[model samples]
Target: MGPGPKVKCPPRLAPCGLRLVQVRFPTGLTSEEYVKQEAWRFARLERCPFHPEGGCGLARHGTYARVSPPGCLIARWWCPTARTSISLLPDFMCSRLTGTLAEVEAVVAAADAAPTREVASEVLRPDVELPGALRWLRRRTRLVHAGLAAAIGLLPGLLARCEPTITSVRSALGAEVALVRLRAELVPHLAALPPPLGFGPRPAQRRSSLTALQQESGTDPPSGTR
Candidate 1:
């Protein structure tokens, strides 16, 4: 849905470049109509992250429309050297997830609070199926746990107490905004780092799971936007 040579990039925006300049969007605006009016306002960009020639070539290439969930427009910045446009995405949504960050957080909380998917569903996601919600939660936990561990230091076997993830997850449970705060601190920074880390078997006994997932998904790593 952004720029680059990949077939998935949208057809609009002149179809060029791989690099983009990202700008943060504030919350409150919702729906396609709202997005259309606001997307253009974030069009301002600067030096390209992918260009080797050292030029602030990011320009107001155009806007792409999105429907579903929040339904908002995604504005793109064109980078000639990268040969594509970069869509400015909101912090509230993951680049790949179909649901909003709140939705994702809801599911994660549900999963953590309940013993079974059915139980969690009954408590929160009564409208959705278990398989879908559980899978999404697993993926997010995988990324967040591993990514955070990678971004910061964690203790090794026997001394692995106080890992950043444990604090973050506990924080999430206590506060509604905790998950969002964690995502803000982690996702964007981790996105640039491909090949997620495998933290190892157990923070207290062996290699953490973060290290394990990295090894498993190493062949094809996340683009970070996910």
Candidate 2:
């Protein structure tokens, strides 16, 4: 009888590249030394069980592999043209069994959760307030106020014809400088100012007294008194 068609084991038989690899050192080696040695070895290969399809290629084609202790390997191959290819990959194969699983899970989770350009753009939405616009508006308003103050300062000599241009120039200069000083001075003055008139308990006491007087007279309090 003809030999039956050769059965190909599923590519998934290869270890997942996403899992962490922990190599235990002999009693003589320190943990730090063991880590350095393994890191160097993995770096030389440029292909670890944690990234089996080999970096970008694996990601693009949705292929992955996982390797476990004592050289247990599993992998998944995907066909880009097939819509169901994603399902063929080992889904959520817990890498928790490995000694370094926590570190591996953390790395993988962070990579998976990283924000894309689209996500960043959405977060910094166009509707958000802009510091630049506020700064520009504030500058323009200050310029307008300075211009108005300068014009007002020149109003006193509008009817005078002798050296009107010089007078206007002087007035404008003085007004602008005065406005700058006033802004500086007014801030401190306002900081020192007490609260507005009638803001204290005196107003409430007066209102109560007025109401009592009105009640004895059996008439509404005068609007002026109120």
Candidate 3:
């Protein structure tokens, strides 16, 4: 019962103590298929996540479903000695945030293609008021842009001197789903950064309800903050 991609952190480093990591698949699998088959049961960890030596009582800890992406269950394990648990999130889904990776990318892509944020909000979220829609669009846009910047710095050779934009990432990686592809490249450092890249701040077992605005804007940092 951590934040479902609805939680936003400040611009500065905010480490949520959650031990969630993504599990990518070799073959192509849609989010729907992943949920329908309960693919998380197939997730494996060769070594103890918390205690990599050999054995530390790391065992399957059951599954938890997310609010978004109906019926999706997160596979998890726990280290009894360490008194901690790790959730193996399927790559098809966005960490911290709700929905699939493609859905997040699509939102950013649509805004990137729009002439202006105002226009993008209108088209992307006509159901909501203009101000709320803009907030929703800006949150995703900022997150994607920030993640891309971090990607450039992380993958110097692959993305050296490249602009931090969706177009640049797509061209550099040669993939349409740039964020998902980028996630694989930055697997080792995923825990250090924010979701889609890393997990953001995790409060001490706190779960707050999302307001109407929060529901519209999945993960918007406070105004005037990152």
What are the TM-scores, per candidate, against the unseen true structure?
0.55, 0.14, 0.74
Candidate 2: tens digits of C-alpha lDDT, residues 32-118: 343334322222222322234432222212223233322222222222212111211111122212222222223322332446523
Ranking by TM-score: 3, 1, 2
Cα-based lDDT for every prediction: 0.46, 0.27, 0.66
Model 3: residues >4 Å from true position, as ranges?
Answer: 1-28, 200-226
> Which lDDT tens digits does candidate 3 get at residues 109-136?
8899889999999998999899788767
Instruction: Compare the candidates by TM-score and give the number of the best one.
Output: 3
Error of 1 at 179 (Å): 3.8
Model 2 TM-score relative to the real fold: 0.14
Q: Which ten residues in a row have the lowest lDDT in candidate 3?
A: 217-226
Ranking by lDDT: 3, 1, 2
